[model samples]
Target chain A: MLQFSFWDILSNLLIATQWTIVLSLIAFVCGGVVGLILLFMRVSGVTPLEWFTKGYIEFFQGTPLLMQLFLFFFGIALFGVEVSPWMAATLALTFWTSAFLTEIWRGCVDSIPKGQWEASSSLALTYIEQMRYVILPQASRIAVAPTVGFSVQVVKGTALASIIGFVELTKAGTMLNNATFRPFLVYSLVALIYFCLCYPLSWGAKKLEGRLNVAR
Target chain B: MTYKLQFAELLPYWDVLLQGLIFTIILTLVSTAAGIAVGTAGASLRTFGPKWAGAIVTTYVELIRNTPFIVQLFFIFFGLPAAGVMLSETTAAFLAMTINLGAYSTEIIRAGIQAVPKGHVDAGVSLAMTKWEVLRHIILNQAFRKIYPALSSQIIIVMLGSAVVSQISAQDLTYAANFVASRNFRNFEVYLLAALAYLLLAMLTRSLLRGLGRVIFKAK
Candidate 1:
């Protein structure tokens, strides 16, 4: 068994932390774009589009992220496409994040009272204009907390990418634990790092949730 | 890409899949029950206990919430053995899952408890109810009614998360899928079947929770 120093494990984990952050950003940005489109499609009131978006959300949300990662990693290989672990991880995460973010944003859009839409329609605003000017502006206020809250899930979800050999924080922890033969110590540090990354967002989410509750 | 989607390859593995499904269900139910117990205790401590107790529960919640479940699972499964606390993969997976579900449920249930109006508690107090009685009859019940949907959703998510335990060779659905896929060399078909199985499981769990909510809360 390979032996590793404490500093060596820490440094490796620190380096791997960058990948975790980068992957999260990539997944967040791409998922945000796709999620926005999905939200629009869901609210467009087109039956097929609604069904398609719903199906997309359910497919990702209903299944485990680990299975999705496995499918992307191994399933794509069968089609004669040489996909890297990074590509597969990113694709799975982006799709998964998009499904959730779409549902989240759609709830935000829906939470705007019906009277706002009716009033906007009475003023002869097109659907696009109403969304751009009236609906979204108000909806965004309600959306902020849940969106921020969901980011915590995204960060945690990125840990699943390590299963496909993406070498993020969790994967680094596993490697270090293997070398050091100290599972609890290595994992506690890993958990600590993740807590540092996630707790502020959790606190912020709670704070925003409180503000939202008080506002209503 | 000339890949044909042949699900027929998975036909023989239906029994294995069923076994995996049963295991998955058992794991979910056990963890969920254990989780609720932990969550209730944590939430109560956080809400009404001394300062140190509240702080400790808060710390536990944050630690579990932030870390990846897989890491948590590894720590329990692989790490514990190093400390001479060996457990089978299934037991470790179940323990990690219960702990994870407990933390999230604590937060949700705490919110539910807090959402119970002060007047309800005051009324319970005025009726000569002891603190424990008031907590049981008023606060806890009302919180459950309010948080049932959120709790149920979390339970379904936890069930989905059980797939990760396959990494430790727990023979959950994902493990079975991995086995069938490698044996049949039909990776796409096996996963598609697995995904459908998961989807069906999710639907079934949700409906069951809905029925449960109706029975428990009388709100359906």
Candidate 2:
């Protein structure tokens, strides 16, 4: 028989928390790249690209991420691609993050006055140059608060990775609970860690939103 | 390797799938209605109630918003029993989802309430209406209309999120997918079917909520 103490459990959970942070970063950074592409296509005034991105966003947004996780985790296996929980979790979360981020950023870009585009194009700027020099810098400022706010969702989203057997914070809590038979103590700490990670971003978003409103 | 989907195998489990879908619907409907009520009250409290009430509700909203729904569900289902509060999986799902929607909706509705022109409430008060009357007829009526799109989106989000209840065997649609996949090892087919169902459910829920909104708020 083996005995574990409180410090042992907390330390182990802390180590697993690192994976949660890493996974969230993976989703956030990769999702940002993909979301920007989608946003550009959406607002680029090209009909087919706009419709394609529009449908893509709806497909991802209109369903559960849990289902998408299961679909990819098992669907890839059908293609004989045995995915580790790490790969599956990252893939599902990245796509989910991209969908929401795309919508958020599209709104920001669209918020830029029509004159910004007209003024840039009147100078004979290419599409890319116009966006780079004129629109995106302005839009990114508006995107900052909401983008940070959405990162909290990605962090919380990583908790679902536990269901697929990813050794993240939530899974560590469940494992510790089984070992210690103290669900109340274990999960309270789990929730606390998430709160600590998330509350700051949410509060910051609120403060930034207020400031942005005042600027107008 | 030739891999083929066997939808035939899942055809036998339609009963289970239908049952789970109905349960998911019930869970969503019950929670959505109650959650909006809770959110409405919380928004009011945070906006107009005493300082203490506002503080309590602010804490509740932050707690729910900042954490994952599955963690909250697990905490209620597994953690509460240790403190002498045991809830069935269905009840736990309902409570967790209602709280989740409540927090999000509180923010949405609060935004709506804030957008109400101050003069509207002032006018209602000057008409000899009590505070409650002004809150209901003047403020809330307009606030709900203003926030209908946002509030409905949050509700559908919670409904899609309810899929996680299956992890605890609450017999939602995902649970049926799990059961069918495990039994037949047609994990791809089963989950694809479930995802399609969820997509349909989401579309149906969105339109249904929009219809309900029109009836309630007279949103054009």
Best by lDDT: 2
Off by over 4 Å in 1: A1-3, A212-216
In candidate 1, how many Å is residue B36 off?
A: 0.6
Provide the DockQ value for model 1.
Answer: 0.75
Q: Residues A16-83, candidate 2, lDDT per residue (tens digit)?
A: 99999999999999999999888889888999999999888888898889998988798778788879
Q: Poorest 10 consecutive residues of model 2 chain B by lDDT?
A: B211-220
Give the TM-score of each candidate. 0.96, 0.97
Each candidate's lDDT (Cα)?
Answer: 0.91, 0.92
Task: Itemize residue pairs with steric clashes in candidate 1.
Answer: none
DockQ of 2: 0.83
- Give the Cα-based TM-score of candidate 2 against the true structure: 0.97
| Model 1 lDDT per residue over A43-75, tens place | 988899999999999999999998898889978
